[model samples]
Target: MRRDATSSARARIGAALLLLLSGSVVAAGEGDWPAFGRDPSNGHHSPLTTIDRSNVARLRPTWIFQSGVTGYFQAEPVIVEGVMYVSTTGNHVAALDAKTGRVLWTYTHKARTEKIFGPPSNRGVAVSEGLVFEATMDGRVIALDAKTGRLVWDQEAVRPEEGETETASALAATLGDKPVQGSSRLGFKMPPLVAEGLVIVGVTGAGYGLHVEDEKGGLDGGSVVGIEGGYGRRGWLAAYDAKTGAERWRWYVTKEDGWEGVFAETTPDGIPLNRDIAAEKAAAEKNRDAWKVGGGSLWMTPAYDPALGLIFLGTGNPAPQNFGLTRPGDNLYTMSLVALDVRTGQLRWHFQQVPHEQWGYDVASPPFLVEATTPDGQVKAVAQASKTGFIYLHERTTGRLLARSEPLITHKNLFAPPSPEGTVVSPGPLGAISWHPVAYDAVSNRAFAQVRHGAATYTIKTVPASGNRPELRYTETSEAKGEPTFSTLTAIDLASGKAVWSKKAGSRLSGGTLSTAGGLVFSGEEDGHLDAHDAGTGEILWRFQCGAGIGGPPVTYAVDGRQYVAVAAGGASFTKASGFGTGDALVVFALPD
Candidate 1:
C-alpha cells in the first residue's frame, strides 16, 4: 500500500540468495533396491508385493537382458526407481528397466590377466544420492551416475608401494631370514559400501607393500589410509567422502613395529603364552595380506542398520585355507560377523563361527536383522545361517549371543582339537548358507534359509619356494565327503528360537528363498525345477520344471496389480564341483489367472 520501498525489496532478494547459495538439498526418500539387501536391515522382504502368489503361475517373461557377463550369476538384481542393476564375473554391470528388463546402460571393467582362483562374481550394486557404485577385480572403486552409465570417478583401491607391509614366499635358502624378494606386488578386491556420507571399502588381498622386518616384528606396519586403522596396507577399511571421493579415515588389523608395545597394554597376562607371543604375533601379522594369495575376501554386500548407526558385514575364509596348521589363532574378523559403528568405522564387536576353518567355510552370506514377536514379547536381533552348519541369532544392540542351531548332522575333524579361534570350521566349504539370500515372513515371524548339508575334506601341500617364501604354504582340495545329497529349507521361529519345520529339497543346489503373502515359499531347485511350498507346513504346493536350471534367488513383484514370481535360472558358475552347466534365463511365473 505504501510507495515502492527499495530496502524491503532488497531484503527479500537477499533472503532468496541465501537459500540458493546454501544449496544444501535433501536426498530423495523414494524406496528402491539401492543395495543387495534392499535396505540396511538385510531384510530381503519388500513391501511391493504387487505380484502375489495368487496369479504367479500365469506370469511370463516380459523381457530379458543378457549381461554378457557370464559365470555364477549369484548377484541379486537391484532396482532403483525403474532401473535394475546387476554384475557378473570380470566386471560387467548392466542397468535395465525394472518393468521391461530393457537395457538402459552398461559398464564393463577390464579383468586382470591372472584372473584365476575364483571366477569374477559380484553380488550387486550400491546406490547413494545419485551415484551407483561398483568395485572391480583390477582393484578399483568406480562411481557412476545412476541415471546414466557415465563414470564419475575411480580410485586405485590398493597398490604395491615401497616399504609397505606384505606377505610372500621366498627361495628355500632365504627361509632362514625374512621374506624379502627382489620383486614385489600387491592386490585387493571387494565392493565398497556407502553409508552416512562415507564410502566404506575393504581389501581382499595383500595390502600394497613389502614385508620388511620392523622392531615389533615382520614388516611391522604399512600405510593403511582410513578406517580399520592399522600400519600395513592390507586388510584395511578405508573411508572416503561420498561426494568428493576423498580419503577421510583408515584402520588396519595390525600395527607397525614400534607399535608392538600397544598390545602389551591390552593382552591378558593370565593366558599362558611362549614369551611375548602377543607382541610377536602382532609383528608377524603386520605383513599378512590376503588379496595377493586369496585369503579373506569380502565378497558379499554388507548390511547396515541406520537406526543403530552400525554396519554389519560378514568376511570370507582364511588364506591357504586348506592348511589350518600354518596360520594359527582365530583370525580376527575372518569367517565372522563384524559390527562397526557407522560414523567412526570402529569395531564394536565380532562373532567368529569356524575358527581355523579348513574347508573354506566363510561367513560370507548376509546377516538378517529380524524384528519379531518373541514368546514373551517382541525383540530385534541379528540372524544368520553359517556354512558351518549353524543358524546363529544374536542381540543386535550388544552382539550378545542369543541362540544358534545345528541344522545338519556334521562331523568334526577327529585329527584336530577344537580349532584355534580363526582357522576354519565348516559344514561345507562355502557355507550352510553362502551368497544365497534368505527371506523373512512378517506374518509368521519366521526366517526361511536354504542350506547344503554335507562335509568337505581339506589338506595342505608345500609348494617350492622360488622367490621369497613365507614360513610355510598350504594346498587344499575339497569334495562332498558324506551326505544324502539333499538341500533343506528351514523355517526358524524367532520367538522360540527353534526350527518350526524343515523340508528336504530335491536337489542340493537350491538357490535362495522367497516368501509370499499367498501362504507360499518359493525356491529354485538345483535339479532345474521351481517349486512353491506351503509356508506354514513346508509342503510342496506346486512344481514347474523350467527349461534351464535355477541358481538365483527368486523375487516377487507385481505388474498391473497381478502378482508375479521371478528368478534368474542361470546355473551355478565359479565352482566346477557342482557339475552344473550355465543356463541363461530369468523365469517369471504367475498363478492361474
Candidate 2:
C-alpha cells in the first residue's frame, strides 16, 4: 500500500479496545505489555488492578531471569500471550515464559563489527505480526520468529562506523590520549517501533561528543573537545518494510536549509538564552559547511498517533554537544519535540527547547500522548518531562504549547554560556532527566518523572599551538564535588501544570516509572530497591532489594488471572563512581497464588 493513501487505514488505533464485560465497557489487553510503552500512546500505564494499593504490600518475588550480561540493564520486557521478550546490553534477546521463569529461546547477536560506534545498551524489543524486531548495537536490524528464536531477515540499516576510529584516533593523539577501539562508533539505544507494516528505527551517537571514562574526563574530553570541524554525522529516522526489510521513507533530523534559523535569543516559551548572536553569525560564515554534520540523534522511544498519522519523539542536542559555534542557528530540529508524519517521514511540526544548544539540554525523556482538557474541552495532547526541568504540554495536532509545568528539579544557571575558567550550572549535560521514561495515569491526570540533581562546571580551555597542531580552544566540564546533589520522583498534575506531590528517593533514582490502575506507581533506585509508590499520595508502599540498581522500567502483566510486576536490576544505575553494586537479574514480583 502507498504510504500517503493507505497510511491511516494501516495504522492501529492505540486507544483501548473496549470490550463489554459484565455489562460495563472495559478496556482489554491490560493483561499484557506488547510494546516498550505498552501501546502507541507510550503512556506506560497498565489498567490491571489486581495488585492495587491494598494488596500490593503482599507482593513478593516469584521468579528471577538472570540475563548474565554485565553493565547497564535497561530492558523493558515485552509480554504477549504469556511470553516475555526482552533485550539486554550486548545485543542479546530472549524469550521467556511469563508464568514461570523458563527461558524458551535466546538469540545471541553476531555483530557485523565488534566496534560499537554508539551506546551498546539495547532497551527492549518490539513484537508485531509474529515477528520480534531488534535494533542491534552494531548497526543492523534483525527480525526473529516470534514463536521460535529463528532468524527471519537481517538488514544493515545504518551505515557502518565509517571513519569513526580514524576520528577518535586523531582526537586522542591530539590530546595525548589513547583511543579506545570499540568506543569509536555508534548503535541503536532503543528498540524499533513497528507500526503500519513498517519498522521505524533511529541511530544513536551520531553526535561528535565522545563519551568520557571518568567525571574529570567528561569535562575535558566528553563534550568539550569538538574538533575536526565535521566530525559528527547527521542523524536520521527511517522506516522499512516489516517483512522484507525494504526501505520505505527516511527523514534527516537537521534542516537542509543550513540549520541556522533566526538566531532566536529565547526558547519557544520566551526564556532568555545565553548566546552571542554577532559572534555566532561571524563564526557561521567561517565554518559554512558545519551544517552537513549537524548533531541531532534520536535518543528515546516515540509515541505514534493513529488519529494524526504522526510520530512524536525527542531529539538529542546538536553535535559537538556542549560547544556552540560550529552548527549555529537554533540547530533547527535538535533538542526539540518533533512530530513527523509516520507514513512519509515528513516533518509535521517541531518545538525546540534550546536554540544554539550549549548546555546539552536535550528533550531527552520520551514524550507520551494524552487527552488533555483545554479551553476547547478535550483535545489530544503530547507531554514531555524535559532536561530543562519542566513538563511541557503541547496540543498534539498543531504542536501548540498548552502548558509548561513548574521545574521538577532545581535550576540555577540555565542556558548560561561556557566560561573560560568555569561556570557552574545546575541541570547540566547529565541532565535533570537523562533518557528516563516518565509514566502517566489518565485516571488522575498525573505524570511521574525521575529527576537527578547535579551540577557541572563548563570551562573553555585553550591549548596553545604546538609544533604541528593548530591552536585549539574548546568548552569542557568538570565534576563539581563541592556542590551537593540528589534525585527525586516527582508527580505533576497535568491539568493545572503543578506538582501535586514529590518524594525524595532513598537512593539515586536512576530508573523510570510505571503506573497501573491499582493506584500504584512502580520505580527503582541505584541502591537495588524496586519500590511501589501510592499514585495519589506519593508514598512508598512496598520495597524490594534486588541486589542491583534498578535502572529499567518495571512492567506489570497478568498470567492466569494473576498479576505480576517485573523489573531488571543491573548494577550501578548512575555510574561506576557511585559504587552501586552491579548484577543482571530480571526480578518478577507477584502475590502468592
Task: Give the number of the best model, judged by lDDT.
Answer: 2
User: Model 2: residues >4 Å from true position, as ranges?
Assistant: 1-28, 163-167, 174-184, 215-225, 572-574
Candidate 1 per-residue lDDT over residues 1-593, each given as its tens digit: 12223432442343233222322122212224445554555655544443435544454555555655445555566655556677655567777766667778888776544422234455556676788777665556678887787888877665424213233322223336533322122233344567777777765543221223322332212111110112122245667777777777765532222222222212121212223345436544643443233245564556666667777777665543444333444445556677888778787877666544445566666788776454556677787767756667777777766766644445454123222232222354545677677787655678888877655444333445444543344333334344434578888776676778888887665567877555678877765678877778888767787645576667665544444466666665333334456655665565445
Evaluate model 1: give its lDDT: 0.55
Stretches > 4 Å off in candidate 1: 1-32, 48-50, 112-117, 160-192, 205-233, 251-295, 372-377, 412-426, 460-475, 480-483, 542-551, 559-564, 587-593
User: Model 1: how far is 69 from its true place, Å?
Assistant: 3.6
lDDT score, candidate 1, position 343? 77
Top candidate on TM-score is: 2
Predicted candidate 2 versus true structure: per-residue lDDT over 1-593, tens digit per residue: 24422322222223453112111121235477878887777888887777988888899999999887876888889898899999987889999999998999999888777677533577888887788988887888888998899999998876675437344454555555522222325578776787677888887776645544554322222333454356666778888888898889988888878588889989989989978998888888776766667778787788887667788998877776677877667888888899998889999999998888877777778889987888889988999888878989999888999988988777878878888878888887766877888998876799998888888788876767766666665666655658867788889999888889889887878668999877899988989999899998989999999998886888999988899999988864434566677788899999988
Task: Looking at model 2, report the run of 10 residues with the lowest lDDT sum.
Answer: 18-27
Backbone clash pairs in model 2 (N, Cα, C under 3 Å; residues 3+ apart or in different chains), count: 9
Count of steric clashes across candidates, in order: 56, 9
